[model samples]
Target: MELKELLDIERQGWDALCASTGASFYGELMTDDAVMILANGMVLDRAGVVESLRDAPPWRAYEIDDPRLVDVGSDSKVLVYTGIAYRDGAEPAFRGIMSSTYVLTKAGWRLACYQQTQISQ
Candidate 1:
């Protein structure tokens, strides 16, 4: 996919998180074997992601910066970016380098993996 398309998809994900629809959005967007390596040191498979997001609070605001796209092969791509998200009543925003990998599938490009590396102030 092109950079714009990839970034749009990423933005959609962030929007979903802000709207408290992440569990459903991610469930549909993720591949069966998808995994998310969270900033909290949890390595979650697709099922785990669905469960966790069910109770996760929505983010109030978010931004993605310095995004770069990498081709893994002919049918796969990865997005790397600096992301910052804030929630109400939180001391600090969630600042991190986020990575998302997508693989082309018959249904469409599906998320194969996602990871968050927390950035320290």
Candidate 2:
């Protein structure tokens, strides 16, 4: 898949976070066995992800920089980028290296895994 297409999907996820709709958004996007490996050292399964995001605070703003799409195989791809996320009343943004792996399925392109690495700066 083209970078733009996968990039759009990534942005849609960020937009979902900004709008505080990540619960439903991810619920639909993630595959049954998907997992989000957060920078905070939490590994969440699909159900955990949905529950965690259900009442999570929204991001005030976000930026995705230097994204690169990696071709893993015919039915799977990984999108990696540096992400900056802002929170209300927070002095500094949360910066991390974010990567999302998507797999094409009968349903559509669905998230297989998502990971975040904290950036020390």
Q: Candidate 1, after superposition: displacement of residue 100 in Å? A: 0.3
Clashing pairs in 1: none
Q: Looking at model 1, how many pairs of residues clash?
A: 0
State in Å the error of residue 118, model 2: 0.4
What is the TM-score (0 to 1) of candidate 2? 0.95
- State TM-scores per candidate: 0.95, 0.95
- The alpha-carbon RMSD values of the candidates against the true structure, listed in the order shown, are 1.2, 1.1
Error of 1 at 37 (Å): 0.2
Summing lDDT over every window of 10 consecutive residues in candidate 2, give the lowest-scoring window: 84-93
Candidate 2 off by > 4 Å: none
Model 1 is weakest, by summed lDDT over 10 consecutive residues, at 85-94
Tell me how far the alpha carbon of residue 69 in candidate 2 is from the true structure, in angstroms, after superposition: 0.8
